[model samples]
Target: MALFGIRRLLTILLIIIRFRLDQLIDVTRLPSWLCILLRFGPWRLVPAPQHNRGARLRLALEALGPVFIKFGQQLSTRRDLLPDDVADELAKLQDQVPPFSNEQARTLIESALGKPVEELFGHFETQPLASASVAQVHAATLNNGQQVVVKVIRPDIQRTIEKDIRLLYSIARLVQHYLPDGRRLRPVEVVEDYELTILDELDLQREGANTSQLRRNFADSDLLYVPEVYWDYTRRNVLVMERIEGIPVTDVAALNAQNTDMKRLAERGVEIFFTQVFRDSFFHADMHPGNIFVSRKHPERPQYIAIDCAIIGSLSDSDQYYLARNLLAIFQRNYREVAELHIECGWVPPHTRVREFESAIRSVCEPVFEKPLAEISFGQLLVYLFSTARRFEMEVQPSLVLLQKTLLNIEGLGRQLYPELNLWDTAKPFLEHWLRDRYSPQSMFKRVSHRLPGWLEQLPNLPEQLLEGPRRPIEMPVPNTDIEHLERQLQQEKRSYRWRVLGIVLIGASLMQAELAHWSPHTLALGALGLLVLALK
Candidate 1:
């Protein structure tokens, strides 16, 4: 495996050299020796391509294979990080690889479903409607005359991905060890996250479930539409879903031709994103233009049609609360609050100086906010904020990074649809409303009501556990007199027993108050009191 990895690494290097991608790197930032080597390498003998740098990069990633192509697709979303031309070229890197043989697709489909294609579907197209690195889709009609698309995982793609993932780890380790900021970047963790994401994509049944959940999320909503997944025909490698017809969200001209309300359409995209993240806590992580469409039925309202649900992201309750608050702070230009939230949420070290962090955040954000509301890029602001936070040693949060990427995609798409779309205006109100609802008394009551039964069930054992503390064998020193030792032990036990009893009584009182009052201030005080008593040594 190590030998194969070395050879694969060489192949990648050769591809980069062949495309002259080294030119893209800033040689001035490199070590003196490496700079000279790159400038005068033997590989430089090969003639450089006539194409521009961006096109060369796109072609080189294509040559590198599916994994790199997917990486390029992800990079394209970060327009804030890459040059506009490069980002634009990378955005054109679609999963339009040459399809495998139709006979192979039929054989795999049959093997997965345990039936012949003829017996399965009323009609199945031999030609693939779309071909991606991981899977390809073909138009089909079920026996029940349901128009659906059958997705078949590419044969042997797993072996290819496995090989590439090993190579990626090798590269990530090199980056982590060699680059000054590599540890801060957490490249290995990022690759691990990417590995999980890509592996999840290989499981068609999981994708089906994701689609079903998303469909249910927007069942009758006008904001977005998710297609129905047919479970009967779905498998680990095979997915069948309702065929959808809509204008690709990227087709601005076509949308304008249909008199689409571009502003409403743009704003709705933002609403759909926040609703998924703040309300549902589940969102489609891979929401590039290719996976999104605009419904033709509602030109005025402009409902979004989304597909490809392989990559999903969700935040913990704490993350949701903190992230919403942080964004609100950023929007309000409350840099001190933003800095404090970072430390409070453990995004930065607890020892981080709040004033210094606040100043850094202000330096990054004040200039951005100076722009007109319509011209401000909310996603870019986040990018800048994260970049600045790196100085304070803020570790990368995989879930938040995914959210940021999706936000960038949504912001770009919204701007394309309507350049004047103020993402701040669309998002602020939604987040404010979500935060209010999340912390409302009714919400608190619901949460308490749900957890009360569990708390009641645990009540019987609480006294014993609290009183016993942690079990450890007692070691007693030799005493001058047995009577003296016994007296000391007795006194110590009495004091310990009293404290334990008091702790139990306070906790019991708190639980009772919680049961009666739900989430009132008195109940909160009692709960804190119980915790404080229990924590006393």
Candidate 2:
């Protein structure tokens, strides 16, 4: 297995060299590259000179396959780390790839659903509607006379991905060890992240489940629509879902032709983003133009359709609360509040000067305040804040990073559709409303009502546990671990408390001594008694 793994690694390296990726970066120094030429030998180089080194590097990765495309997608989001041109170019990494043979697709569907394609669908197209590196979609009609789309995974992709991931890790390690900018970039960690993302995207069943959960999250609303997953026909590598047809959000001309409310559409995009982050905490991280479409059914009040649920971002409950508060603070232009929230959330170092951080935030935001509220971008505010906070030793929050990136994408799309869209106007109300809902009495009641049954069930055991509190073993000598740790802390606190009490008592004794200077013995005894009481405790 080890020898075959090494051989597989060499094959990927040769592919990389054939595309001339070695010239784009310092590759011979990379162990994977050395492993390649040493085993696979004299490589052929493809001439791609129109693009600069960075662009060529991105293009090469795209050519290498889906896993690399996913890596490029992540790099595109790190605007602070990469140059504008490189990040911009990487953003164009298309997920499109040639589809595998239809016969193979048929076999996969039959194996997963335990039925022949002919029995499963009224009509299944041999040609796919769209093809991505991970999966290809074909329009099909279910046996129940419902229109749907069938998504089938590329054949043997898992083996290919596993081979290349090992090589990627080797290169990432070398970059982190030798490159000056590698530590900040965290290449090895980034590769590991990419590994997880690619592996997740491979599981069509998981993607279907994610789509279903997100659909449930917004089932009552018209803001966004997630296609219904046909669980009866879904499998690890194949998914059957409700087919949706609408103009892509990028098709500005089509949206205009349908008389879509551009202003409302743009404003609602901002609202949906905040609601998903602040309320649901689960957001479709991949909201690029290709995956989003605008509903023509409601041209006056446009709705959004979201697909591609392979990547999602969620915040911890604390992160969600702090993020909402921080956004509210920014909307109010309360820079101090923003700074305080950052410290409270541990976004900044504990010893960071709050005033200094506040001033830094003010400097970044004050210039933007000069513009109309409609013109000011929340995305830009966050970008500047992140840039400033990094100077204060703020660590990156990986979950928030995706939200920030998706925000920028949504903002860009919205502004292009409607330049006068006031993101602040749309978002401020939503944040305030969400805050009220979170802490209101009614909300608290609902929470308790949901948990009361479980609490009541466990209540019977609580008194017995309280009566028999600290459990000890009968067979072994007890270790006073709790007392030992508490004793050290207790001693420090006791010393401080003792000094305070002693100082107050001494002051009282001095006053008594002053008043009874002529007959001091009786007053001195009273003072001694007071001191004794103070010491006894």
Instruction: Work out the TM-score per prediction.
Output: 0.84, 0.79
Model 2 whole-model lDDT (C-alpha atoms) = 0.80
The global Cα lDDT (0 to 1) of model 1 is 0.84
Off-target runs (Cα >4 Å) in candidate 1 are 1-10, 24-36, 50-55, 76-89, 175-186, 462-537
| Candidate with best TM-score | 1
Clash count list over all predictions: 0, 0
The CA root-mean-square deviation of candidate 2, after full C-alpha superposition on the true structure, stands at: 12.9
Give lDDT tens digits, candidate 1, residues 36-136.
99899998898889999999999998998878898678667554345668878998887778899999999999999999999999999999999989999
Candidate 2, residues 1-537, lDDT tens digits: the string is 688777866766766675566555454555685647544555443443576766776777776677788788877887656667888889888887888889999999999899999999999999999998778999999988999999998888898788778878888887787655667667776777678778999998889989999999989788998899999999999999999988999899999998999999998899889888988899888889999998879899899999989889999878888888998888788999999999999999889999999999999889988998888878867877887888898877778778889899999999999998888888888888988898764464344346445545655665564444434445755477766775566566655555434534553554446445833656545544544555554
Query: Which candidate achieves the best lDDT against the true structure?
Result: 1
- Give the whole-model CA lDDT for all candidates, comma-separated: 0.84, 0.80
- List per-candidate RMSD values in Å: 5.0, 12.9
Residue 401 in model 2: shift from native, Å?
2.0
